[model samples]
Target: MSRGKHARRRANRNRATLEGEVAALTAQLVRERKRLDQARAGARRADTAQARLTAETAAAARVMAPVEAEATQTAAAVGPACTVLTEAARELARCDARLSRAAGRSADPARLRTALNTGVRAHLDSVHRSAPLEYHHAAFRRRRGVDTPLCRTLNVGGWIPPEIAGTDHDRIAAHMASRAGEHTRAALWCWAVPPWMGLPDGTDAPGRRTALGATTTGAPDLPDGEFGGRLRAGAVVGTPWRHRPLVALPEDAVDLAYWYRRSAWTQNWHPHTRPVPFWLGDEHAHGFPRSQPLPPGTDRRLPFPAVIVVFESGWQLPARHPDPPDTRAPTGLLYARGHGPTTPPLEQPLYRLAPGTRRDELATPLELVDRYGATVEGLIFTADPDGHPTDEFAWCLAIHHPWGLPLGRITIPASRRATHWTTAIDNTLAGVCLAHFHPTATSTGSPGADPSSANAEPHARDDADVHVLDIAATSPTTGSHRTPAHAAGRAAHLRRATWRYQPVGPGRQHRRWTWVRATIVGGRASSRSTVYRLTDT
Candidate 1:
């Protein structure tokens, strides 16, 4: 036993004692934690049980209250007044059944009318006449009728008045018809296409109407007729049935008569100042040539978007159908056009007069030449190089260009032995000249031609480049409505053709760099281009 050895033994004993204390304390902490978890779980269970009791108490109260309320309602329904009304209703049903047996299956309408002279209809007629005109007028403007609301309110207390009950069908139907009318009248304004192409005013008024497409009650705001009130009460104006002509039309009117059918069957926008738009930017546009040599003064170098319209005729009938017997109705080409590429006239899928070939639409008015004489034509848009809007024939005259490409030519079959594109508009030639014609500085020499086509002319040689004009010296069918101002507004449309940075990379290039000139010809599009690639010489 040295002093150092004694000190080491003391240290070992002290370390062992501290280890025992630490192990005992850890065991006590574990037991305390286990007790805490158990106590918390017990509290949660107690809370859940209390909530369940509260919910069950509320549910029981809810269930009992309805049962008690229903019992009270049942007693009230069986009161003396209800008992009397129920007996009366049963009596009426018995009376009606007996009346049916006595009257036989088909009662004579005249005799029935005579017997029920002072019946429900008569009473309703008197009531209608007595109503202040303003009240009924509101029905058309608003969505309610006077008699309908009166009938409803009277029946609200579970008591059906006999008069209203007897006339239930008539009143209810009138109310329903009035509701059907509310949308169109309440809409403020909209347009519909008339079936007949030769209608008096023509077809198509643009956004001239209010967004709703309703009109301001024309002429007088108040009714002005022999029986306007009665008519208003009985009929809803602007409805297909109510507005239709009562008398039938003759066979000659059959084609135009198609408009009298249901509104849903007729054209959607019609009955306007004219079929073709009066103004170029109006709901329609002029025609632009796809390719042509400049007529005279036309600047060929100035690039602009060439445009044309593609639209369906009034009806989707064949490109050429039998003209109506009424020859006075102008059987030749009439154009019906509209504004926009949105919802363009898509001819339904049908068998083309040719076997197996289906053309969804007619490409141009020229297509109808041999058929119904290609009387009617329509165009959508047209513009020239100086940002000026010019139509097909006029474009050539204005630009000193010759009509090129397809040019919507109506070539006469050699068998017909007539000139191609001889139309009524070409008054000069009865004999065949060019199927189409354009005003030229040189004489066509065949028959009746414009004076401008004869004698020494500065642009006579330039007209030779154009196929349409070269066909004959006769003046081409220029736009009936095309004006110089129309071509002057070309800047707006030309802006649309300027180069835009397409979101394209070299990897996804559908096209390479090239000088491309574009034009919209009728509904089809074509371009003349010269491609170029970069190279180091």
Candidate 2:
């Protein structure tokens, strides 16, 4: 019994110790689990941090990519020329637009060409006053013939009459022919819209008065103008007023000038007495037939020959304007008997229309030409008047001889008239004579003239090709002259009729002879032709 009680006591002690150890182990396990959970949480946070860092790095690369690309492009696109190119592009755009607009407008080609030349004309007076080299040296050393002052300019072609041409435009050939006379005048024709050209009131117009207009030349029909003033769009091709040779005026408006001369080459002026007139919609064909094309300037067949004119004019005191020899004193007896007290003969009178003269008449003279030198002058200039906008002016031109132009003496029967022209040949004879004629519808129909043969053989003289000289057509002879094509069809016939002289020697011949060639052009081929013989040398 005593042994059994001691065993029970040992068992109880062992149980208590085991229970305490179990509690201590449980606490240790709990602490370890807590530590492990904290470590696991830290690892998860580290993974999230790594992922965020990787995302940020990728975003930063994306943000920098476009900037880098732009920087590269900028570097490639420039050094320093970029600014210049940009500015140049802007300027070019502006200039191109301006040029395009100018080209589109229906402007006179001549005026457009002379845009720069206008500066010269506008400032010619100032330039002359400075006594530049052009003024002093350009006169070909020819004296300014005070003794026999002569101012002359060649006349440009005129508009074809509406009655004959049915339009404003005439053939280049016909335009040149009509104004070939030595005394041809210069006048330009213009058209008017509903609003006619208007002139300021009270301005004097030197015109032959009509029974109706003498008192009725009153107010503008329309406030804008009487006739729509600006030249019809595309009405004419060349400058509205063909090359108007600028006149050298004095610096002071009223100052007198000394005699001046110009022996210089120039295109001749056109008649200003009456320019060719036209309505708004006239059928004026501006083309030449294929057979007879207008030749280049190099051709001798040109109607208007290149010429050097000896133009001279100026105000001068008479060589001897001695006060009429004091009629009451010394030469009274002779002066009174022969001629009544000669009121000191007036000086050579210069003629120009009063400044503000306006006209709508076709026949009245726009300019005056007397014996004293006054050749080409504009009567009135309109910068911007009613109806007409582009600069316009009336002109007076004189047709005269150029230096070295061959002189001719022609004799034709009164019934069969012909226009005559002459040009000198190289020391062979005096000159070649040309006769102009229009088509005459005859009963006997003639063959079609193959004038291509005429141009086939070109004569060479003095290292230059000698081409056919020209003669202007005369006024209508018989046929109802219509289009330029019709006129060109009836060309005058040509066959050389050389008049020979006495053969004096081998080289020199004693010949006062005449020459004639009957030229056939247009469609008019004739069976026979009348010949004219040049007489005077």
| Ten-residue stretch with the least lDDT total in model 2 | 256-265
1-537 per-residue lDDT for model 2 (tens digits): 889998999998999999999999999999999999999999999999999999978755755677689888877788557888899888777756654544456756675556534432222242355676655544534455343334532222122223444334354334334321111111111111000112212233322112001222222121211111122222111121122122321111111000000000001111111111111000000000001211223111211111111111211111111223333311321221122111111110001212222233211111111111123211111122232212122222221112111111110001001111111111111121111212222111124433224454322111111122122221113343233455554545433223233333467655332222222444343433122211222
lDDT of 1 by residue, 84-142 (tens): 99998897777566445445667776655654553322222323656887756665446
* Candidate 1 segments whose C-alpha is farther than 4 A from its true place: 1-108, 111-125, 129-537
Q: After superposition, which runs of candidate 2 have C-alpha atoms over 4 Å from their true positions?
A: 1-357, 360-367, 371-537
lDDT of 2 at 109: 63
lDDT, candidate 2, at 353: 17
* Backbone N/Cα/C clashes per model: 46, 43
Quote the positional error of residue 129 for candidate 2 in Å. 32
How many clashes (backbone atoms < 3 Å, residues ≥3 apart in a chain or on different chains) does model 1 have? Answer: 46
RMSD per model, one decimal:
32.5, 39.6
Q: Which 10 consecutive residues of model 1 have the lowest summed lDDT?
A: 394-403
